[model samples]
Target: MLFELMRKREGVYNEDRKERTENRPIEEATVPEYLVFPLAMHIGAPAEPTVEKGDKVKVGTLIAEKAGFISANVHSSISGEVIDISDQPTIKGIAPCITIKNDYKDLEEPPLYSEDEELSVDQMIEIIEKAGVVGMGGATFPTSVKLSPPAEKTIDTLIINGAECEPYSTADHRLMVDHAKELIDGVRILVDILSVGTVHIALESNTHDSVEEMKKILDKVDHINIVELETIYPQGSEKNLIKKLTDREVPAGGLPVDVHTVVVSVATTLAIYEAIRSRRPTVKRITTITGEPIQEPKNLLVRVGTPINHLIEECQGFRSKPGKVIHGGPMMGIPIKSGRIPVTKGTSVITFLEKEEAVRSERTPCIQCAECLNVCPVSLQPILISQAYENGDIEEAERLGAMDCIDCGNCSYICPSKIPLLDNIRSAKKEIRARQEEQ
Candidate 1:
């Protein structure tokens, strides 16, 4: 029933993902002199600090433990003493963080789970939860919650999302190229845990190298297959990805689980393998630091809590004074006003754009050119949503599927007038959700 469907849509093809880390090997960043573990790396409630200032810790030591079932644990990426536990610069602005000054010993903490024994579904869930795995694709949803779908949902398909669809981002591409075995192993574990019928390793056609690397392992498994997707923006969205791979339309305001499917980022899959086997927490991630402003753009195996300046230094500082430093891809990335912002589990790309590429042009009125609609991956009328939103018509925007806006930034990127359609839609979505909550 599954075949390659080349039905193109409202997505733009911009090759801004080149000239940097996509082709370079991932390098391990030197242990930063200091680390700052944000208590709120994942979604839901932030973790509570378990260690006070001045408490010596080792690599993998639990510093800020999960506060609730939906939260993720925060661990020390290096051996150090807690210098402070207070508000610090993070991707999401100033959030409480546990600051540790590295002792350089790189000491360790014991593994959370032993590999000598086989783990059942429940055991796997427990280990994954404790290991602090989350949606590394920037969603940062607790991975454990995802692995344990509701009893009512009969999940049948598992998709390993290797679609690094965003321009100027290639961390996942590099991961797929360098760590195919570990990625596949993670797929196997998820299949076993979820008891899914079939698994698909979906990669965009642009990343032929990654596709070739993964194709080598596809033959070893019967239920698992390689799905080469057309190079398109936001195809990595679970709904879009599922439709391209399986032709299943995820219901409005519903999750992929509603369609008996789950789509996890490939980086997250690799984390699963390492978390279960090596007993490592979600302490590090492969980040693509690129853009014309960077002197030596390359990918780095960055430890969580490393400062943005650490990467700037690793890249030999900026080529020219960067106009913007965004955390993640330019399209959907949250802007970091300062490089002091520490990297989190969700931090994927540290883009340093020159003023020419970074500065926003003066916004003109929407021309109804339908360019946004033409490139919208979700088929929603972005201008309509933005109009309703700007006019403060919350109900109208809600009716226009504002809540369904994936924040892909395609609408904003494609606007002829440089209208901030995505931002307005996002504002509308927040209001819509608030209205829903009030009910």
Candidate 2:
């Protein structure tokens, strides 16, 4: 596995800072006056709203039900009255949200997990599905579906990804530091569910303290081992992590399971533990709100539906005029038009770039420098794919393996001509998928 990654490695890519440097302890975000719950926080179809406007609700109340087996449930993280069931701005655009006015009473229905017992795989899956635990690392894939791999596929490895490779995103790092026990328990739960004998937890070597801390908590578990990885961007992506750790490259259009493994993130693991241990549904998550424009850089324990404005204020507001506000890290994160977007299970970092940092240069034509191919974590030729996309040749883009592009933006960062390689390929991939669906 190290053979491929070892040959070429850039310690830190452009457009990203290696260290977030805040290192502050987790702080509780102030409850917003209103909480907006987007019904479609997860990967699949949007959840169906269960509450109507004006319905009185408490914390942990089911606000939406799962629309399909691949969807996760949505709950009210605040005790308030349902103000409206209308389209609200989200990181993914305007989605239907259950708007609530916070009363600040925070009363709960009841404790969902009363006792702990040896749970069978079926029982474990049931609790996980009911808890609405999706991947908190930003993918937001339904965890239950990941746990329920096809029976024909023999899952041999379960890897816990703690590599906070995305620059300006250390939500996972804080989770490992403050909630190591929770992360470990989540890994153990996954161990039992997958029936995998050995578990490898991968963290960037920069986060050495996290490895020591997690090892101390999981020292007795012989089946678990810690794997330190290079602090490279996109190291946390499932396919990339699988290859770097296990020496298995998922074929084009293949999944981690094709290599008999499943890779999960540190935040996702902690979410799993919380859902099973406390029976707490996926109602909230810790997010990193940082950048050059913010007054204070913080890792906050924010409720699911809390607005970004609340967090910005909690962080002491902006220090300078904001140039661009990204929904995640600068590399793969999307730029948001506004800050009113509510927090969701997939929320990671709210990155604000200064005017200079957000500057977009003119694209001069591809220089064919092959720099993109060298820096691409997936080793795909981004220039060819971008060319294919620019020509509107979906077949050429498909032939160039556009779908294999991880959208890491490394190519765009490396291009001297300032071509938008990742964005172009991304558009082409979307069209390719739509064509496939049409067929």
Candidate 3:
């Protein structure tokens, strides 16, 4: 009976999703006026700037060099003059950025590889590492590091995340439909590199067309399977996707690799394809500009370091006062104070929410309704962890499994009393990690 109830809920969710997709058309945007590429977009050590102010750089020219194993290379998105290489606002609050004044010259850098050349797995890994390619789906973890796991841990399955379950984010959806070939090539590259036994492309039932398109392409190929996931909030999460697809719970305080699996985002896979096959670094990404305030919602292939303001203007600027400007999707993205920040490799969307939609009410006491727990894909007790945070009991929170929270924001979404469950849980987790580091 319980299984039947769950199936009924999933069916209703799928119906609502079909209606939404039917109403929206996948639209694309033309090139923007200017792109502000930043130096330190990825997580590791900031790339060292190679070009100075006033230097002319061509598209695909290396502007910044990787400084460490965990870092990624930075490149010029357009053939332009280096207007300035100094501190500038970035999507992650503020950071040093390289301002390139586009000359619109359309000059190209020498091709990194010839079309006829075929690279071995080692060569591909070397190219990807040097290109500074990282996970483009917001995690920004160095892709090479993930590809080079320890020898003892045998990898059998490589899961490509196409779920894209976040609300108001369509970059992945459009990419799957538009760049199907590149995505598939990327999957093949990963399969070869990791020597994985099988490849699975997991997409939510919400994106049936994307699945259909992918299936049409994969029909000719072997060993690649498409798994349709239940349309649920946070279905795109690495842990949650692993659970729903394989029925394998990633052990608490463990990673996906611990269970003999590796998950990569569709965007990251595409980036890998470009890096290995084309010999290009990750210097730009597709960002969706959409919201109530946005004049026209569309997907743009923005160069890394393009200022947020340039994108807003390209989208015909906002129609009214925007209550908040978020760099990624609404559910898991961080809200930026200003659009002056430049785009980065990890940025996938620029969302502007109106006042009514953006404002959050004050938090209230938990009513012990257990809605959060029920919806939580990780099965963590958000109410208890949040209570521990309020009372400043770090150890209690840790003991109650606060650290296992995936920070997917589903608990916060399901809470009726407006409790900031994920936020508090994140705080508690941070404190716990800090204490461990200090000790």
Candidate 4:
């Protein structure tokens, strides 16, 4: 089954690459004039604002301080003047932002540490948390917390996810190609922190070039292994990858750590390398700006607080006003009503879909074909849960296994009748959570 899945993925990837090469656009004429930095981009308690309106801030300067265990700090992306500190439109919708007017001076602070100081495991973890590094792969979970697992949970493996499973997102691919050494170094750092058994770098079979590049770097180290994965949807998922490589199923409602494993994305590892080596927090990320409506598509090293509109402008603006703008990949990404939202750590791609592609026909009655059941990675009956939610039967939905759904959108993507099985199932799950909270 896995072999067939891998063969199909290789075909899809080749087709996608050919199409991208044919449709790729030229460089845009204009660069961005300003970047609106949002103060509350990460999860958990919002960072405390350190700069007020009209304050002059330099690039890499801390603009907000971490407020809690789950939160990360915010930094200035450019050397500029703080024009305003007020609610502004962002990619996540309108939120409070620190609007900075660029001076284009390009001023930056000195490095946080000298090259002579080879940091120990304890020192690296402290620097990572202080620098506010999070999972840049999309989850935005605090890196510090992930490094500190309980004593009872023995971490035996560290998996580096280079799957790049989503279509039209090439940030991870480009990183793996260009910075394989840094990624391997970051994996070493993680392994040292967890005192793990071995490190496995998992790349999709479609990205054979990247896998080879990573293998060359890992050959120098003794503990690292490069594992090729089947090119299936959600192959990059922590649970799925854990199961595929280690044959250890993360029990339902549990985490990969429960199976004595840890998964980190390639981008996240690169960020760790930067945080410890350069003593820099995660103020910027590599983002892929692409789609049919985009004038040009290229992987960009974008600042965290940079607005989506700014990125589009950098790409020479859209060819036409897209029917819809998605913040990440089409399958799991959320639809953005406006492009003015600021990019966060979890923002991997800004995709513009044309009118024809964005249109979804009205949902029809399910035919009980059980197709959703067959494709589900978690083996949940999406139809039953969705139907229960549509009828307002919350308890019935829970009993039918609404909570087991990973919300990967595979069911909706594969449905023949265009029924929004994932949407309805998600709604049911939300209600179940609310009910549990009320109790």
Candidate 5:
């Protein structure tokens, strides 16, 4: 039975998923005059540029090489001349960026790897690494590294996270509905590589179309189960999804591989399929441009280096003045200081909140309500961790498991006192990491 007795999931908040773009088809965004590519888009070491200023590049051109084993490669999304390479404003902060002047040729570089012969597991992985496939669910971890777990860890399960639970984000949902066959093909490739015993496509109940569409495709297929989860915030998290499906808890500071499982998002899976089948690199992705301030809320198939301002313009500008512009969903997205920041691999949604909705109420003292505790998926006490950090107790915060936080921002959302609980915990986690490096 696909619907087995699941462990009663706890500490998850039922959120109103403002999936405004669910019914909208994925529209291709217009290419802008200039595109900016950031080197440090993924986790681990930043990619090193392979091309310099005045060099010509085409779509799928390798502009940057992986700096380390954990980093992914970077490719040009548009045919252009490298105009400048210097520090520029990004969603994170000032970082080394590659600015390209679009030639408007719409030319594409030929496939680097041939797909004429059947691909071996190693060859498949190599292709993905070259394509710069990373987790598209906001964590931008190199997909090549994720697929290749340590030899000791026995991976028994592969879970495709279709639970686009973050409010106002429907990129994954649309991918499933429109491209179910491609997703299943990607899953098969992953299964061959990981040699997992079982495969499960996990989606929230809110994604009815996705579930039904996938089921239709997988009806003849075997060994792949479709599991439905409650529509809860952070239900798409790797740990929580693992717990609900396999009754396995990834220990604090551990990964899904620790529990003998692997989770790949819908967008990343599709990228893998494209990389292997057509030898296409991760040059573009589907990003949801939405919010009440947006004149047109729709899902756009956007190039990697397209600026946020271009996307805003594509949406017919704002219906009203936008008070806050975020890189992803409101719950856990980073606030974009400028629209100049280009869309990275992990960007799934660009949320524009009106002035009224973006207004922050004054933060009051914590009331010991413990609502944060009740909603924390990882069971960490945000109150204690935040307090420890406030008192300059970095070690204390570490001991309280500040590093285990997924930064889901549920604590701050549930806090009745309006405390910036998530911010403090994030600060504490950062300090803990810095001190550890010092040691």
Candidate 6:
């Protein structure tokens, strides 16, 4: 009964430019001589290092343990000696990082569970938690916590997000096309964990190859079906995807679990399968290294803790001097000062922008065109929130629903005056949150 409406909603279509790497087969990146593992890669408390400098670790060895219930464990991607543990630069600022020198010995830890071992719901959750799977679509929320919702919140529908809607990112697309059966089986694992009968794998209409491949593998699977979403920016966002497909509007400042649904990314789903079915931790992921400046754009299956510079080199280095290097897609990616930043579980795309594309236009006063409001997926008034924040009126901003902003950056992109509306709103939200915690 879901998706029958397909009601036209408010969204913007940007230049997807998926052709750069959607058709390119995924290339496995070479192991670097050294790797950097930041403890704060995922959301919530930073994991504490379980291994210290000079300590030996093998692949899949627990290098860092989850510090709290909200955090995730960190595993080694290569067998090596812990060279150092210190605060290192990351996509986010400096954080505690464990650096390792690769021995290339490929020593791996033993499996946590056997395939034939039938596991209960708690065992499956333990497998996911131990494997350190997070929302690989970039949210980086611990997957174990997401799957374990409060009992009062009855989850009836499960949405597997396959919509690679962001521009120039095809890691998820490549995963679906190359490993459709694995993705499907991964969904089945989630279905059993959540005990949900209805499931939908949402993909964008442009990714026909992924859709077709998934369809071929999921043939005759009555419990799980495919839903093609319009090719729109932020279509893969959990809240937006849930609303568009199920017609269930997650309340302001609420999560998908609050609305009787749970959303998992395609990458995270595959990680689930590997953690349970293949006996692996989330040490590697497929990342897109593409942009006009890249000499040879490609989708690379890279290991966690690999340097960004290594990925750039794998793409044949930049053809020209890049004006900007973003850690994710251009739309919502965080711009980094250097390529020394190591790849984390959430690193989906490393986009390089040419000079002309990276230049920032002068910011002018807003002309009151209301363009930002027109494109906000959550229907928040960014301009008003920004104004309230500028005026030191955090109360007004809070009342105007500043916390509801998804930080999708659509307001900044759509602003006629280049007002940086999203930045102001983000700061406001942070301040508001800080003040709330203080109280």
lDDT of 4 by residue, 164-264 (tens): 77766777877887778888888877877888877888887777777777778775645788888876777777877888789998887788889999889
TM-score to true structure, per model: 0.95, 0.95, 0.89, 0.89, 0.96, 0.96
The root-mean-square deviation over C-alpha atoms between each candidate and the true structure, in angstroms, is 3.8, 3.3, 4.0, 4.0, 4.0, 3.9
lDDT of candidate 1 over 1-439, digit per residue (tens): 0111122366766655565677898889887898888999999889999999889999898888888878998888899799998898888778898899989998899888766888878998888898899999989999999988889999999998988876788899989889887887788889888888888888888888987887687655557888888777777888888888888998888999999999899989988998987888888999988888888998899999999888888888876887777888777887778778888899888777777777687899777787787777778999999999988899999999988888988878777698888889988988887887799
- lDDT string, candidate 2, 118-186, tens digits: 667888788788788898888899989999999898999999988887778878888898888888888
TM accuracy, model 3:
0.89
Write the residue-wise lDDT of candidate 3 on 1-439 in tens digits: 0011122211112112122222344454444556676767887788898999989999888888888877878888788888787777776546677778788886888767766788887888878887778888888888988898888878888999988776677888878887888899899989999988778898877777877777777745558988888776677889977877777879988988898899999999999988887777776677778877888667878777677887787777878989888888666787898667877889887777888777787777778887777877777888999999999999999999998886777677667788988789988998999899899
Using lDDT as the measure, the top candidate is 6
lDDT of 5 by residue, 1-439 (tens): 0011112234444445455688998888999999999998898899999999999999999999999998989999999899999999997799999999999997999996865777889888989999999999889999999998898999999999998877789999899988899898888889899988899999988878887887777745558998888777888888889988999999988999999999999999999998987789999999999998899898999999999999999999987998998899887888887999999999999988878778777889988987788788899899999999999999999999999999988888777788888899988988888898899
Model 6 C-alpha lDDT per residue in residues 115-226, reported as the tens digit of each score: 6899999999999999999999999999999999998999999999988877789999999999899999999999999999789999998888788887787757556878
Which pairs clash in the backbone of model 1? 10-375, 17-168
Better of 1 and 2 by lDDT: 1
lDDT of each: 0.84, 0.83, 0.78, 0.76, 0.88, 0.89
Better of 4 and 6 by lDDT: 6
Cα displacement (angstroms), candidate 5, residue 59, comes to 0.6
Ten consecutive residues with minimal summed lDDT in candidate 3?
Answer: 1-10
- Candidate 6, which segments miss by more than 4 Å at Cα? 1-9
Which of candidates 2 and 6 is the stronger one according to TM-score?
A: 6
Clash number for each model: 2, 0, 7, 4, 0, 0
| Model 4 steric clash pairs | 90-340, 90-341, 91-341, 91-342
